[model samples]
Target: MDLINNLALGLGVAFTAQNLLYAFVGCLLGTVIGVLPGLGPLATIAMLLPVTYSLPPLAALIMLAGIYYGAQYGGSTTAILVNLPGESSSVVTALDGYQMARKGRAGPALAAAGIGSFIAGTVGTLVLAAFAVPLTAVAFKFGPAEYFSLMVLGLIGAVVLSSGSLLKAIAMIVLGLLIGTIGTDVNSGMERYSFGLPDLSDGIGFLVIAMGIFGFGDIIKNLSDKGTKRELFTKKVENLMPTRKDFKLMLPAVLRGTTLGSMLGILPGGGALLSAFAAYSVEKKIRLQPGEVPLGQGNIRGVAGPESANNAGAQTSFIPMLTLGIPANAVMALMVGAMTIHNIQPGPQVMTSNPELFWGLIASMWIGNLMLVVLNLPLVGIWIKLLTVPYRWLFPAIVMFCAIGVYSTNNNTFDIWMLGLFGIIGYGFVKLGCEPAPLLLGLILGPMMEENLRRALLLSRGEWSVIITRPLSAVLLAAALVMLVVVLLPSVKRKREEAFVED
Candidate 1:
């Protein structure tokens, strides 16, 4: 009964004229960015953070949330048509989707992707709504020690699950923690790493770091790369609907992918990219049906499963951020920044203090998903036309937008300079093959971890044993240790490496 009432309230809030309009705009923009290679939801959100300042908090959040999930819908369009994945999560989609396109079944492949995504997205939203309140209730039990231990676990999970070298991921986390400590010490009222700069007194602006690393850095990297030529398998996408056989093959895969993605999306360092890959691996293990295309050879199941998983993963990834104030991924980190800008603290209190925003955001996701299905299917030609725009013209506009967004945050030139500095650092990370996602996690969680650790110590009279004496904190810390141990095992290490390698 309570859940029904809450959803009812959410729908009421979501149905507002302004909220609906922004949701549509967000969905539209998300599709546009997702159709263009090299641009992603992270860079796009970072660039738009400053713009969200003037809008109502719920509307801003609703729109931003739309962009994140809507990208999942648009990414498959390019992957199916041209073998170019618009988003990282769509990388697996290109493997078999392109093959399907080559077989002149591009329409059925795209239709399967769209239909699977819609079902998964709808189911994922329901799952989020069902779980968010219960999780928030559980979160209210956490104390300082538990929160700190949870963050430690989150960081470790990031290290274990992230691609490439474990050493590099750890190093990035440490670097981010160091950078996070640059501002003045809040309790002591003394500068720590300010270097006597007034701007550093309040700490480095989150917008600056976000824009520099993701926004400006991406532009720099995209410019340096020798652009690859993409060939469209079919210029005209006909037969918008899938055959009965295609549906029979697609339904089971979509259901399986949706389940796997929902579970994985809640874990730290797991989101659309990981979920999609895992789903594809699972599909490969299942034997093909009679008369169905084999796996990776234009199989409809291949197109459907990963597409469903990625979209479902994208939607459910919001669970941790909304319920615990913990970012499950880099995009969630940006969302935390968004909430902070509106003076709305994330976590359990949000449901009690701002139920409208919480429920409204949840309801808007369903509406946004419905909008994406309509937008992606019929308007396939427009998205393809967008792909033809040259990088040379698109990049400069992105750079300019990023500059303006960063500068507008504080109206300070120093922020712009910081943006440039971080941009260079971000590019350096790319050159060194280091993943930047962990760094963002570290930066966002570092200060909170420090504060909680200090508070727990102070309350326990500096005994330090309180972290283990408390059952919840002890369990969380133990989990982190176990995760570290399991990940370091030789067999597990090899499997982890295999999981991240793209075919």
Candidate 2:
């Protein structure tokens, strides 16, 4: 009953003329960005962040959130049409999606992804509505210790699930922590890593770093792969619907992916990406008869499974951010920043104090997902045509858009300079075989972790043992330790490497 009422209220807010228009626009733009090579939802959202400032908070977030997951849907288009993944989560999609395209099953693969994404996204949004309030209620009981413990668990989970060398992931996380420390010390009003630079005092801009690393970094990598010709499949897309046999195969995969995604998405870090990969792995493990399509060999299950998981994960990833004030990914972190700019406290109190924002956002997700499906599926022809644009003409436009977006955030040249610096660092990471996701997780959590640690110490009168003494905190620390140990085991180490793409 409460769910229905809240949803009704949310619909009331979300269905307004202005909000509806923005949601549709965001879906379209996000799909466009997703279809383009080398761009992802994070960079698109970061680029569009400045525009949100002019709109109501609910409207702005609705649009931004639309862009975030709408890209997840659009990403499969490229994965099937070309062998490129337009977004990180869709990389796995390309492994089988493009293969399916080569086998002239492109239509079914895309249709599976689109339909699976719709189902997962809708169900995930419903789950979010169901869980948001109770989680927020639970969040009310959290003290600094609990909050810190939760964040610790989140960071650990991120590192554990990340698809890279464990050591490199840890190193990247530590580096992010160091980078996060570059701003002023809030407690002491003292500069820490500012090095006498005014811009440094505010710390590195999250948007700048995100854009540089994921956005520009990807562009450079694609450009550097000079001879890698993107073969666009122009094969006729007959039967743009999954067959009954395809449905039978994909149903279980979708269910498995949705379940995994819903569970993991609540954890901080790269939950969406992790869930996608995990879903694919799960589908692969479900043994099949001889001559059945292998996991990475253009199976329709591959398209449905990961697409469902990714969308479901994307939807639920908001739980920690809204309830606990802990962002699960870069986009959620940016949402937090946006909420702060609007003077909205993001923790448990948000449910009680700002029910409108909470419910409105939840409701808008449903609206946004519906809008995305309606906007994306029939427009496949249009999106494919976009693939025809030569990379030479497209790359410069993308670069220019990125530049304009970065400059608009604060209207400061310093941010542009910082973006370039981070771009170089991002490229270096690619070269050095480092994964940047864990680093981003650390950067997002570092300050909160520091604050909680300091407060815990202060409350305990400098007793460092307090962390171990508190049952919750102790459990979290133990979990992190256990994770480290488990990953170090020879069997687990090999498995972890195989699961994650090479850096």
Candidate 3:
């Protein structure tokens, strides 16, 4: 009943004219960014961070959150139309979605992605509202040992979830951890990998890495595809609405994705991205009846499942950040920064101390997600036309935008250089057939893991056994180990190889 009352209060706050306007604007901008290749939610949110200083904290946070999920919806549009993933979470969508476009079924794919997202986003928000406090209570019981174990599990899950050779995924994670070490050491305040540069002391900017890898790297990959002119799937886009068969196929995928996403989004690391990949894998495992579009040949389930999963995951990710002061992803970390700037501390006390803000943010997710569907569906035609634009024109413009956006962060050109360097690295990863998703998880979790490891050691006076001796930590570590073993088994290895090679 108290939860109901608080949610009502939240609706009141979120429904204000100003908040509502921002919500609309946020969804619109998010869609635009999502459709534009290379500009992810992290880069977009970071670029917009400075501009939000004058706004109310709740409104600002609400807008940023809107952009994050809005990008998810927009990403599938390009993935389906151009075989280019506008967002990393949409990469799985490209497998079957692009095939659908080739067959002139792009309309159904887009519809499935959009509608599935709407359902999942709504259901995920409700789940977050119901479980956030309880989840936080569980989080509160976690000590440093437990936190470290959780991080280990997160990293392992990341590697297993990546779509590539296991060894390659491991290499990517190691590389990410190495990149994560470039900053100064927290305990001794000594620079471990700075290489004598002052900027290195503060660490490689996440904005640079994200922009270079996701933004610039994409540009290079698309350009190298041996096509002088760009190709767009110009299917007259008849019957913008989905058919009955489309609904039948997409419903189960949406439900499964929503379930998977709601559960995984609460974890740390690339929870949303992992949810998308996991959902796609689940969809593939289910044998289909005759007449069903085959998975990876442009099946609507491919688009619907992952799209719903990621959006739901993105929504539920707020649970950990809000309730436990634990940032599950880079964007969530920025949210934490925003909250701190507003003189609000995130954690268990958030519910009691700022019930209005807490509930309002939760309430606003529903509003923002609804606005996304409304904003994106009608705009699909507009986005599809973007694929017709030439790479010669598009790449340069994207590079320029990235430069300006990175420069705006700290008014520093060094970040631009870092972006270029990381872009090369991103391209290298592409050539090596390695997935970058796990790398991102490592980058996000490395510092947190280091912090928790040190705290646990300090609490136990340097006893290494504390991690395994603690009940919660032991269980988490054991589960992670078991998962790793299962994934590495000979039969599982053969099956994974077959899945990747499946025609």
Candidate 4:
């Protein structure tokens, strides 16, 4: 009954005219971005962060959230119609999806993806709504020691699950922590790393870092690559409905994928990309029907499973961010930045203090998923048409928008210079085969970690053992230690690397 009332309240806010309009616009933009190859939700959201400054907080968040999940719907379009995947999570989709297209069954493959995504998205949203409050209740029990330990666990989880060298990931986290230290000290009232520059006084703006690293950096990297010709599988898509046999196979796969994705999405470093890969691996292990197609050979189950998992994962990844103030992935880190921009501190208090924002954001997701299904199925032709626009035209426009967005934030030339510097630095990271997600995570969590550590020590009269004495904090730290040990094991390390291999 309480859930019903909360959802009713949420619906009331989500159904408002302004909120609905932003949701629609977000879904539209997300689909277009997803249809276009090489553009992901992270870069798009980073480019648009400044634009949200003018929007009401609820509306801004609703739109950004729409872009994140709606991309899951649009990504499958290109994967099925062409061999290219529009989003990283969609890479697995192109395997069987393109094979199905090649076999003249593109329509069914697309329909499967769309239907699976909608169902999975809806389920994921319900899970989020159900779990967020309970988790928030638990979060309320945390003290400074526990909070600090939790963050330590989060960073360790990031290192364990991140896709590259453990040493590089740790190095990136340290660099981010160092970068985070650059500005005025909250307690000391003195400059730490300003180097006498007024612009450095406030520390690096999250917007500048986000736009430079993701938006501009991606554009520069894309420009460096030689253009490859994209082959469209079908000029005209027909039979948009799936057959009974298709439904029989996809339904079970969708259920399994949704379950797996929902669980994984809640874990640190586990999001849509990882969920999709894990789902694909799970599907491969299940025995096939006698006449059914093989895993990568135009199987409808392949199209449905990973698509469902990715969408589910994307939605549920918001759990930790909204409830615990811990970002489960890089995109969630940006969301933390978004919330701070509105002067809203994320965590357990948000539900009690701002019920409207909490419930409304949750409610809008259901509407957005419905909107995506409506947009994707009937408007398939339009999305395919968008694929023909050349990268030459798109790249310059993205670069321009990124510049304009960054410069408009502070109207300062120094920010632009910093943007350029970071863009080059971001590109360097790409060149060095380093993942930047952990760095962003570290930067966002660094100050909070430091503050919590200081508070814990102060409360304990400077006893370092306070961390190990508290049961909750000790358990968390123990979990982090176990994670570190598990990941370091030779067998586990090899399997971890294998899981992240794209091909």
TM-score to true structure, per model? 0.98, 0.93, 0.84, 0.98
Model 1 over residues 230-259: C-alpha lDDT tens digits? 786536789878999888899999999999
Better of 1 and 3 by TM-score: 1
Q: Which pairs of residues collide in candidate 4?
A: none
Report the alpha-carbon TM-score of model 2 versus the true structure: 0.93
lDDT of the structure predicted as candidate 3: 0.81
Writing each residue's lDDT as its tens digit, candidate 3 over 218-305 gives 7787777776344576555666678898888889999999999988787755456778988998998999878987898878888889
Over 4 Å off, model 4:
none
Candidate 2, 237-346: lDDT as tens digits: 67788888899898888888888888888876655788898888888888985666987888888889999999999999998888889888767877777787677877
**Angstrom error at residue 382, model 1:** 0.2
- Whole-structure CA lDDT of model 2: 0.82
Lowest-scoring 10 consecutive residues by lDDT in candidate 2? 227-236
- Residue pairs with backbone overlap in model 1: none
Judged by whole-model lDDT over C-alpha atoms, candidate 1 comes out at 0.91
| C-alpha RMSD between model 3 and the true structure | 3.6
